[model samples]
Target: MTLTLDGEKIDRNRFTGAKVENATFHNCDFSGADLTGSEFIGCTFYDRDSRLGCRFSRAQLKDASFKSCDLSMTDFRNVSALSIEIRECRAQGADFRGASFMNMITSRSWFCSAYITKSNLSYANFSKVVLEKCELWENRWNGAQILGANFSGSDLSGGEFASFDWRAADFTHCDLTNSELGELDVRNVDLQGVKLDSEQASQLMERLGILVIG
Candidate 1:
């Protein structure tokens, strides 16, 4: 059974195991609410101001899509989010550690200081997202869309960016050791103080059409 809520005031309601589809909520407060095993498909949680976004602390959001929602300071720790789409949300300081997602797309969002360590993010698309100072180590970002994203001051070891477009991202002071950079395109991407492996350096030189003479 699925529940549809539109233009309603659902402040702090327990929506465990609930299926919300095509709903639009405004000025609703979901702070400290437990949405364990809940699925929100094509839902919109809109809040005009950036100071106070919708809160989903420790909510179980598996296989869901939160479109155009403001999740600033939203606690997403240890939540299972498989095949989720958190589109265009402000997730500053959002804790995503220990949470696993597959084929996920978190596009057009500001997720600064998002603790996303030791998680599986393979086949994920985080393109055009502002991920400044985000904790993204030991995670699987292989074949992920990280273009035009800000990864400044973050440790990105053990992640693979094979076939990733680096034309518009900022990697200033980022640690890229032990990471895979398969055929990286470093056009317009900031790489100051970034440690690259031997293969990564070769790929950049090869893109520049510069061959080393013996």
Candidate 2:
């Protein structure tokens, strides 16, 4: 029985295909909103006594969808969010610095899309976001800042990523299967079409000591 909506503005609202449930939205703004194919369930948008969340700056959010949302410290700066679908969201320290999940064709060619599965996104910032070829599966990303982020050809299979650095984010052809990759320093992060398994490729070849016996 939530339905709070504190500082409501609902900027340029449309809420396309709306289906909202268990709403809260404390510092609500939803700037330039469209929310295409919207479906937010169990929403909160983080208030927690004036901690203030909801903003969605420049939002259009194509194919927007969320589930079990809290969206802690949410802002989602400069959003365009193609095919967005954040599942099991918590979104800790959310900022999404200049988000744009691109779809452009010309002018340096673009191809990005969002899915953001099993989200927690601890310390989320995503500075310089691009989100190329995205799906972003099984998310937690313990300390996600992602400076100059690209996430090239993303899948990010079964992610957790404790204290994530990974050379300040590019993850070329990413799919890090069954991921927990804490300090993934595979010769300074450029595992072209990366898709590690088999005990994380024998723990990154025993940290380059190459002791993957048998």
Candidate 3:
């Protein structure tokens, strides 16, 4: 079934297996909506609204702005987006594998236990965000700002985090195997009680004060 939402206020609607392609939503509100198993390809969501359990697979969201919305458990795997603003949203348990986010502002968002594997998160701002137990494998986070964020128990293997500021961020128990940590500020961040390998610990000790004598 094909659904088109154009300049309408649709609240609390449960749509499953619905195809909404190339539609434009202007100032439409979708608060408290259950859009599970719905596909939105090449759609543009303009304005602020909350969406719960919005399942999307192979959807294209170019130039979509999800500002100030609660998108908890929104599955957006293999989606491509440009200039998306997901600011101040609760995105816990959201899946974003192979998703591309260009010039996105996801600041102050809650991404607790979210899965973001092989995603492009370049030029994104994550200030004061919480990403506990999130999976961020092989993601591109170049030139991102992650000040005062919580990344405990998160998997960051093979991720590119070049030139990012991690001041006052908590990375306790997070995996950093083969992840790029270049140009990151380790002085303001706390790495105490973090699970690190011998090579990772040696690299961190070079920046932080750790006396090692054999």
In each prediction, how many residue pairs overlap at the backbone (N, C-alpha, C within less than 3 A)? 0, 0, 0
Q: 1-214 in candidate 3: lDDT tens per residue?
A: 4344655655544433355665655444454344434455545443345433444445545444453343444555655544333443444445555454433347544334344565556655455555676666776777655666677777877778876666646787778788877765556666655555566657777667785554
> Best by TM-score, which number?
3
Q: State the lDDT of candidate 2 residue by residue for 127-176, as single tens digits.
A: 88988778889989898898888888799899999988889878887888
lDDT digits (tens) for residues 61-157 of candidate 1: 5444554444444445445555445543444434454454432347554334344554445444455455565556765555555555667877787
lDDT of each: 0.56, 0.86, 0.56
Cα misplacement distance, residue 21 of candidate 3 (Å): 7.7
TM-score of model number 3: 0.51
Q: Report the Cα RMSD per candidate.
A: 11.5, 12.3, 11.3
Q: What is the lDDT of residue 155 in candidate 3?
A: 82
lDDT of 3 at 141: 72
lDDT of 2: 0.86
